[model samples]
Target: MPYIWLLPAMNKNIVLASTSTLYEGTYLDYLLPTIRELYQGVTEIIFIPYARPGGISHDDYTARATDFFATAGITVRGLHTFDNPATAIRNAAGFFTGGGNTFLLVKQLHTLQLMTALKQAVESGKPYLGTSAGSNIGGVNMQTTNDMPIVYPPSFDTMGLIPFNINPHYQDPIPGTKHMGETRETRIHEFHSQNAIPVVGLREGSWIRVKGNRITLEGALTARIFEQGKTPYELKTGAIIPF
Candidate 1:
């Protein structure tokens, strides 16, 4: 059985991935098949590069996505290139948000007032793909992100395409090491102390795939799951997350 959203009317087409590339892999090469299926019948997509990983320019970031998608026979356009971004989103065939700094991405989206527009477009059933920081925005809020607060957004709020938050590039605790830092689990525990939203610790090579009312975990690895008050657990590949 497929996982169902707690909220109703979640009929959108979306692929919220843990990362765009795997170790020793090319950009988006690991997800080409998934991308092809998600954007079926669509020839072009608007690439949202607001996250700007490593301070890369929008044009350069978009060029990377363009090059990758071109292999799949799809055209790519940067959302920044449009005169009116909101209008561009509304008219877009689909959207692909690449990974980067969540803080910067959210700041730009809210500042430009494009958050709601992008949300509306995706909710309308346009194919949407997100990776890393890009996938973080699909959650209830950006508070669970692992990124540093390099910039401040008007709100920690995000698209909430999924009913829960996503912790992309989630890493497990190293069994033995002198390095001491808060585990991803500890930080998420801190988040749960104040917020009741569930969070999915999406591992690399895995993703949440949503089609119409069904949402399923894809790829080889198991995903860690966290709820506000319950013990953390793992859901294996193809498991329907019961939020």
Candidate 2:
């Protein structure tokens, strides 16, 4: 059976990947095909490297994405390449936000006043792609992120492109393990204590495909969803999320 429902009227396209890399090959190797399909008409992409995964420099991060997208015959230019970040996003053919520290990314976005521009572009029917912290910002706020507060932004609020929150790199409690850290589930429960917005725990291999009002869960794994006052439930692959 087909797992994806083609919605031509969606008017917007977004890819929210839990991680940029999976198990090994290369950055976005696991999702290159999907990326290609989602970004069909896009020729050049505006890369937002503020997240700076591994504390890498923005130029370095942009270089990595440039190399990856080159495989798809698409050109990638960093937002920093332009004199104005907001203008860069507003005029891009497509948008891609790489993963790193969600706080840092949010800070840069708000600092440059590009956050609203990004939301406007996406809502205006531009194709958008995000991974890790990038995907976390697609939600109502970054409060559901698992990353520590390395920096403070003007607000925890994000693009709110999607109605709910996204908990990327979600992991379950390993049985027979001696680790005493709070499991991802526990932390999400704590988030629920204060927020009513539902959170989808996207495992490393899982992704959410957003086309306007419809969202479909993809990949080989099941996503864990946490709702207020309700037990976190597993949403299997091919499930259509009620976002």
Best candidate, TM-score:
1
- TM per candidate: 0.96, 0.94
* Cα lDDT listed for each candidate: 0.92, 0.89
Off by over 4 Å in 2: 1-9
* Candidate 1 TM-score to native: 0.96
lDDT of 1 by residue, 112-176 (tens): 99999999889888999999998999888999888999987899999999899999999998789
lDDT of 2: 0.89
Total colliding residue pairs, candidate 2: 0
- Report the C-alpha lDDT of model 2 over 1-243, residue by residue, as the tens digit: 343433322567899999999886679999988899889988999999998877999899999999999999999999977898887887888899999999999999999889999988887778899999999999999998888789889988899888899999998899999989888898989888988999999999899998877888999999999999997789989889876
TM-score of 2: 0.94
